[model samples]
Target: MGNRVFVVGVGMTKFEKPGAREWDYPDMAREAGTKALEDAGIDYRQVEQAYVGYVYGESTSGQRAVYELGLTGIPIVNVNNNCSTGSTALYLATQAVKSGQADCTLALGFEKMQAGSLGTIYDDREQPMMRHLLALAELQEFAMPPAPYMFGAAGKEHMERYGTTEEQFAKIGVKNHKHSLNNPYAQFQDEYTLEEILASKRIYGPLTKLQCSPTSDGSGAVIVASEAFVDKHGLADQAVEIVGQAMVTDMESTFADRSAISLVGADMTRVAARKVYEQAGISATDVDVIELHDCFSTNELLTYEALGLCPEGDGGKLVDAGATTYGGQWVVNPSGGLISKGHPLGATGLAQCSELTWQLRGTADARQVSAAATTSGVALQHNIGLGGAVVVTAYRPANR
Candidate 1:
């Protein structure tokens, strides 16, 4: 890396259910991109490149989105990494600055998804998740949506191995929903009691409808710059440094073992998080706030162990002890997470970035993590895709 990359600004739109609004992806993109630029106090002409992420779109959707900012003629690269697409775009933008390819780059992601459980758009082509489906069949089978079963099976395995309970998983939904009450951008902000969560219609295994992320339409963006660019623009007061970031894909362990936990990306998350800790010279205990992928409450629980927030298979105990919330070890998902905040596949990761940046800047007024706000604290992020990929990143305010 030739230069240290810092995020100078971040922005996102309120996450809404699919087709709930009149706006299209381009409109969403423009709203988010403009906010990021405005936050950075820069013009589109200053941006040297763009990396846009989306899963369902026509060719050059990135180009169309960028045009909403300006036809600056900078190179625009489109990225698709399943659910990890947003963070993958962020990774590319950070690299473009770190490698001295550009002083400033924009990472933007948006999605306009269809209602209901996700389905294949290209049924005639080779499906990327076929192998994953095969692995699922080996473990347990379900008649409902494929995603819930994958993560739900992981939760079931954790229960069998470590005595985790259905109530424990339901608590995650309760917590996130409570947190979302403070986030205006979240799609679902109504808090539910544990009993309500448990009583909601079951999707798969112990998972309930309240425990899963809904199909969402939204956009988020971040403006990243090199140290030199920040200095030149006098943006030192607001810059957040990317202390460390790492991405990992599936390994032999994903398939070699029949465990549903590993099959649903536990190993990949563990590896990526370890790499991030190594790069940042920090431990899981150092993190004060987290915005992890909570596509399902089960995944959130699985991730606690994967990220070493607790001993392996003790994720249920971790949450039950109040260790993953505001007054505990860390404030996980102060933004309400995917379960309550909504998961726009292409935009979820950047939304995490946006929330963390605000928290670091002491601007997350309603949902601020108190201890983290009081000190020079670390924020941890985890975004995963099941085909599979995981990105773990560490952030700190630049002055810290």
Candidate 2:
């Protein structure tokens, strides 16, 4: 690390179904961005650079969103990387601070999706995911959304290989739904029984409607500053340091293996997570809280092995042993995760960063992880975009 960087504040709007609220993307961005600035006790003029993430927007949307904060002449970069867009923005912001290029930087992400599952918007242009789709096509095809089919096939393979059951996957939905009940910002607060989760209308393979993330409209932002900036501003008590982060793209294994698990970018997640662990000088066991990408329930279980949370092919047994929920070995998705918190394309990753920051600050209240509630607090975040990229980050309280 060149210069230590810390997140002094974070904020996000409560996610809602597309068109469920009367707000536009700019409106969401304003609300979330202003809140983060206020939380940091700074004005927009203090921000020297900004990275805004989104997928379904036109050019300069990042500049437009930051204009809501102030018409400061800051450099605003627009980023798009599928589901990992938000974390990509956050990664850039952290780098700006750590490289001593900027004292204060903002990472913002928002999306306003249309109703229903995601679909192609620009058929005329080259699709970024075309190759990933082709790789997916090499496997058994299904008459469903590409996302569900890709991840579902992975789940099917995991079941075939490791004896994982449908119920085992459904249990993740149950646990996350239950966790969402206590999160005010979650899109779905109503808890569901494991039976109900299993009984819900199936989307693909073993995944039900409850297990898949819905299209959502929302925004999330974080304010990162150098340690010198944090201390100068007397923000130590509320600061959270980003210890390590890494981003990786799909390797030849992603397509060469002809495995749905690899095609869906599990290998990318594994590689990025491993790099972050090594850079942070810590292991998965040291993490007290996690906010891994759970765009679908199958991906969550697939990620457990990739992130080294459990032995390969042991994710089902890990859940059965209750090692990934409150009062367990680690509290995963205490903010309800994308399964309940909603996936607003761009906002998802920064929202995860916000949740982990709150956890590290011991301010998550009812959803507080056991480690934060009683002992040292450490957080690990994993975000992925299937065309394909993965970002893994580690965080801890600055005062620690």
By TM-score, the best candidate is 1
Which pairs clash inside model 1? none
Q: For each candidate in turn, give its C-alpha RMSD to the true structure in angstroms.
A: 0.9, 1.1
lDDT of 1 at 345: 89
Model 1: per-residue lDDT, tens digit, 338-367? 999999989999999999999988899999
Query: How far is 388's C-alpha from truth in model 1 (Å)?
Result: 1.2
* Alpha-carbon lDDT of model 1: 0.93
lDDT of 1 at 142: 54
Score candidate 2 by TM-score against the native: 0.98
lDDT of 2 by residue, 183-301 (tens): 99999999999889999999888899999988899999999999999989999999998988999998999989989899898899889888988988899999999999999999999
Identify the runs in model 2 with alpha carbons over 4 angstroms from their true place. 373-375
TM-score of each: 0.99, 0.98
